[model samples]
Target: MKKFILDLIVKENEHINEDYFVLKLTSNDKLPHMLPGQFVEIKVENSPTTFLRRPISVNFYDKELNELWLLIQIVGNGTRKLSEVQVGDTLNLILPLGNTFSIPGDKNSRLLLVGGGVGFAPMLFLGAYLNDLGYRCDFLLGGRSEANMVQLNEFKRYGEVYTTTEDGSMGEKGYVTQHSLLQKKQFDMIYTCGPTPMMQAVASYAHKRNIACEVSLENMMACGFGTCLCCVTDTVDGNLCVCTEGPVFNITKLKWQI
Candidate 1:
């Protein structure tokens, strides 16, 4: 897919909570084709301490609205600066970066989308698209607490949303891997993104059941494009750049011990 350095208008910047915020941007020009797992590198402004641009997943895209959503957590100086951005502000973004989620094309496809922490950002868009495709999709989100399990309502609108809170204060008392949703149903595919351990666990479960699985890697990225070489992950195919080659990779390609 072609790339663009678009200075998009910040249509809305709403803080979901003290820890998370969602930014909606609109492009004055035409946007390139953006897929569910792809991300964008936004040049951060007003933060003297941060020099590098931040890479965030494309949360959702509305073609008719010409709008793109980025679900972000205030994890560092760059993100904190972004949280302060207001409507009408222009954000320079190198976008439609990385590869996309592999949609199960079959109408009867039964899928499970798993996400941990801020990893949930990309899954909503993927699930929504899958729903549009008439596929049976379920979402499994895991966070440290109910507070971290931020947008269940939005997720529920797309498909069945199951959650796990580490503190036992939410949907399920254990991690996402322990959620009953997995045991209650058989899935054609499992797509996940999260902490290393969590993803590995999900992959192991998928492997044990011989289910096709793909994971969106959340490696630290500097450049949105592959030129940076900072987000390389060891794969069966060799060291691959997660930024460009993927933010998404099939579990068969990964060399995890699981």
Candidate 2:
């Protein structure tokens, strides 16, 4: 698909917590189509320290509203600056970049969606899209505690939601990989995005059962167009740019230590 650069106005800037926010953007022109696993690179205006744009996954999009949702964690100077923008502020972005996750072709396929932190960003889009296609979409999300878990209610709108917080304050008490459902390998495919350790564990578990699995890598990206090679990861085929080639990779395609 072709990519486009546009300045989208912020329709809403909702703070989910001190560390995270959801920015809803609308374009003056019609919005370009973007898949669930793809991301956008936003120019960080007015922040001197933020020279490069930040890459954030597409949380969801509404065609009728001409709106796109970006679930952002304020982890650095760029995101912190982005968090301060007001409604009606225009954000310059180059987007609809990178590869997308595979959707099930079979209507009755069962799938497990796993996420952690802001990595939970893309699963909502993937799950809701899958659910609409008649696939069983189940979510397993992990955070440090109840205070850290954002958009639980939003996730539940798409599928059966299971949760795990490091503190025993939520649905399950450990990492998502420890959830009993994951151990059973009952799903047709597993899709995950999160901390490297968490994703590695999920991939390893699925690999052991010979189950299909895909992971979205949140590598530090400089140029979203893959010019910088800053986001390349070691794969069986050699180093590949996470920005252009993926933020999503099937387990078999990756050469994880698993």
Candidate 3:
């Protein structure tokens, strides 16, 4: 896909919780075509301590409104600075970066999307894309607690929503992999993004069941292009840059034990 560096106006900076915020950005011109599972590198304008642009997943895009949503978690100085932007602020971004989740061929293929914490960002876009294509989607989301589970109703607009939280303050009292939906329903394909351990477990479960699976790795992608090499992951094809070759990869191509 073609990449573009554009200044987007922040229409809203909604604080979902103490840790998470959603930045709704808009451009005067029509936005470029972006696929599910793609990301954007934002230039932190005023944070002197931060030298690199922070990479964030595309949470959702509303073509009708010309808005792009970024679900951000304030983890460091860079993100902290970003979270402070006002409604009229201009955020520069190199967008539509990285590969996308593969769409299943069969419309009837059962699909499950698993996400944890802020990793739930991309799953929303992916689920919406699949839902628009007449494919059924089930979202299995996990977080530390109910506070961490943002945008539940928005996700439900695209598909069935299931959830898990470590504190038992939400839908289920365990990890997403432990959700009862997995046991009750059979999925033909599974897509996941989360902490490494969580995704590994989900991958393992899918592998054992002989289901097609893909994972979006949360690697450190300092540069949205391949030059950085910071987001490289060992795959069956060798070490590939996640920023360019992926952020998304099929389980068979990954070097994960599963």
Q: Which of the numbered candidates is closest to the native, going by highest TM-score? A: 3
TM-score of each: 0.97, 0.97, 0.98
lDDT of 1 at 122: 91
Worst 10 residues of 2 by lDDT: 179-188
Give candidate 3's total backbone clashes.
0
User: What's the alpha carbon RMSD for model 1?
Assistant: 1.0
Question: Candidate 3's residue-wise lDDT over 9-71, tens digit each?
Answer: 999999998899999999999999888999999999988999999999999988889999999
Model 2 ranges with Cα > 4 A deviation:
183-185
lDDT, residue 204, candidate 1: 97
Candidate order by decreasing lDDT = 3, 2, 1
Greater-TM-score candidate between 2 and 3: 3
Better of 2 and 3 by lDDT: 3
Which tens-of-lDDT digit does each residue in 107-141 have in candidate 2? Answer: 77789999998889999999877876677889999
